[model samples]
Target: MARPFRRYSAGARWYDVLSGERWVYRAGRVAGIGLMDLQAGDVVLDLGCGTGLNFPLLRRAVGEAGHIVGVDRSADMLAVARARARREGWSNVTFVEADAAELDVDGLRARIGAATGRATADAVLTTYALSVMRDGAAEAWRRAVALVRPGGILAVVDMQPPTGRWRILAPLARLACALGGADIHARPWRLVARDAAPGSVREAAVRGGHIVAAVGRSPGEVAPTARS
Candidate 1:
């Protein structure tokens, strides 16, 4: 079934503000740099790309020669992304309106590589957005895995349930969501971590909480193990 796009459309304007506060803290730039190992001439897909907040960072990584395809279910969000692309004169970036769960992976692959004259992306980045997806994230991840060619990477960042005593911060997590127009307590990261292939999931502690960031190739390809 097609996912509801209205949920994100209504919140598009507020998405960036909420994400900026939660993820863009001290050392976030550094972490983003590390997570997005972009290369010149590489093609990238920014999934659940809200307001295209990650565009600048992605542009820097991919360089002028590469391209970024920002996909989101919200037309409002894509509008912001398109406007930003125009304002920045980034002709290489394109925004598409599509449900994350039902994205046209083959079509996108053709678009990204066709424009760049390449066969596959160097990386795919999804940040902070997947945790809130209603369902079908597993299929989404599987599609992501299939979209990239051998040796490419999938970088994901999302909140995790607090561990041990830090679980007390559950209220803060809810506040972060409330401020951002999201569920007060969504924990899709746990599901991803559980289903993720062993040695392919890494956890990064952001502020007082943790976010999972994983990188790997297609299921059969040998890729770096999850960093301990």
Candidate 2:
């Protein structure tokens, strides 16, 4: 299926607005920070890093010697990220334009190797992006997993179905997303949770029970992996 997020290049400004007002985005950033467990010289990947909202956070965690790559499908979004990087003068960061589902893992490793002489990531993060993938959420998860070297981590934070009887609230959330020019219905949070890989799932609620943040690891330290 054609994903709604692929249309996001045109809606970059609208997304920025939604992210600013949404508590989910805030919680996701916090959760991503905790899950990343960054250290000096660590290499990190921020998949679907729209407008580099979390770049500053990642930059702080990684420090001067660390490296961060922010990947997004939208050139428009990447433009914003680039502008931010330049404005902030963050020399440790690089932004790339690419689809998450189709990202070339080896090519990415090669680039990182050239930059840092390594083929592994200390952390990989995807915030509010996986749930909207056109490929099934599982495929997205698998692709994300493939990016990490053994024992690395993948962390994802996005809007999810409300826990318990709050299911009726989804419509209101959808309406709010629509007002911001986003297609919330295109990303089904509950479906992503249901399809998540076992043995590595950790989840939490945000926005007074309106959104969720989930983290999955590749059977190792808290560094972070996944799709929806």
Candidate 3:
């Protein structure tokens, strides 16, 4: 069992600095959000939103008119996220502490609806999060995808072994992931590859392909109707 939620609890305060955001990782979030093509008033769900690392990007993409509902299982992580929001004076973000893999999408939708007056979000994003879910990752992905409105977006960014020449760093990559309580081989981006509209999927790689971001339009933007 992953005990790092507790381990992470102690490190939440310094996650931004110690998480290697500057030297690595940030590019994945950038590419993922860029592919989202988010508009000004969209509501976005940030799953496993550890310390709100994606907040600045999501915030910039959505702007002040939009809302962000971040869900994480760690109270400590959410505490940092909440503090970040307060520091930035961002009134548009909300943090909910719950396991994304086990989240109640209907209730979550209701909560989001109550806040945004919309039953579903315009986009759903997860970064280096699914792989950490272990056995719960698939259910988490399903619930997160279901939380988006039809025609909305699903973006996932995660890590795998470094590719080609970068393979020389494979051991280092595994070390980073293992230390971070992540499954380096997850390749969770496959979820988007398998489910998105054929032409709507966009993919990008960074850090020698150790990190990947995939964005795709959800199935059925509009419900089919009866013909006259």
Candidate 4:
């Protein structure tokens, strides 16, 4: 976490500009959130939220009545995220500055309950954040899932080497992932498929499969129709 946070600190101010939000990474989150199919008044957790790039899309889905809990370890990145919420006059958004790997689940639950009157979120999302967690990725993912209620949504959007004709851009993709402290080979979205209710998984591949998004209901629910 510190390694990625180190790079994030130096680039936090310029992240939205240089992070390829316009032409690249944003599409992954869009696909992932779309698969989540969030409803208005839902309480969603944005794990490793960074500079709140996902805020606009999430706000649109959940609307003003819903709550967003943005979690990240980097103070610099959280600073930018806070600025975004403030600038947008988003009163429903709260932030927790903590490493997802070392998060105190009970403390987080209490906080979320206090903020939104619910201990568990309706859905939890992590976009382009897990692979960068390196050794702590799985632990972080576990803690994230614990913060959601049974049958809540789980979504992951992460990177991998491009496929098909986009293979020609693999080197550039690797370079981008390296600079961002991500492991392009991680394929973290697999966790969604693993934990999803049977036949409930929804998936999409964007940016020629370099960016893959997977979403599904967490355990404890009857399976729903699948989509891909």
Task: Give the higher-TM-score candidate: 3 or 4.
Answer: 4
What TM-scores do the predictions have? 0.79, 0.79, 0.94, 0.95
Question: In model 3, what is the error at residue 36, expressed in angstroms?
Answer: 1.0
> lDDT tens digits, residues 120-200, model 2?
666677776765664545565566566566556567666644555777777776665544344454443443344344666
What lDDT tens digits, residue by residue, belong to model 1 across residues 127-156?
666665646666676676566655566676
> Candidate 4: where are CA atoms >4 Å away?
222-228
Query: Which pairs of residues collide in model 3?
Result: none
| Residue-level lDDT tens digits of model 4 in 1-228 | 677669877899999999888999999989999989888888899999999999999999989888999999888999999999999999999999998999999999999899888778888999989998988989999999998887889999999999999999999999998899989999998998888788889899999989999998988742322111
Q: Output the worst ten-in-a-row residue range by lDDT, candidate 4.
A: 219-228
Model 3 C-alpha lDDT per residue in residues 1-228, reported as the tens digit of each score: 358556666788888888778888998999889988898888999999999999999999889989999999988899989999999999999788888878998899899988888888888999999888878899999999888877888899999999999999999889888778889988999999887778889999999999999999887745312100
* Model 3, residue 140: C-alpha shift (Å): 0.6
Provide the lDDT at 177 for model 2: 54
Ranking, lDDT, top scorer first:
4, 3, 2, 1
Those runs of model 2 whose alpha carbons end farther than 4 Å from true positions after fitting are 1-3, 21-24, 163-169, 178-201, 220-228
Q: Name the candidate, 1 or 3, with the larger lDDT value.
A: 3
Model 4 deviation from the true structure expressed as Cα RMSD, one decimal place:
3.2
Clashing residue pairs for model 2 = 153-224, 153-225, 154-224, 154-225, 155-225
lDDT of model 4 at position 150: 78
lDDT of each: 0.64, 0.67, 0.87, 0.90
Which predicted model would earn the best lDDT? 4
Task: Order the numbered candidates by TM-score, best leading.
Answer: 4, 3, 2, 1
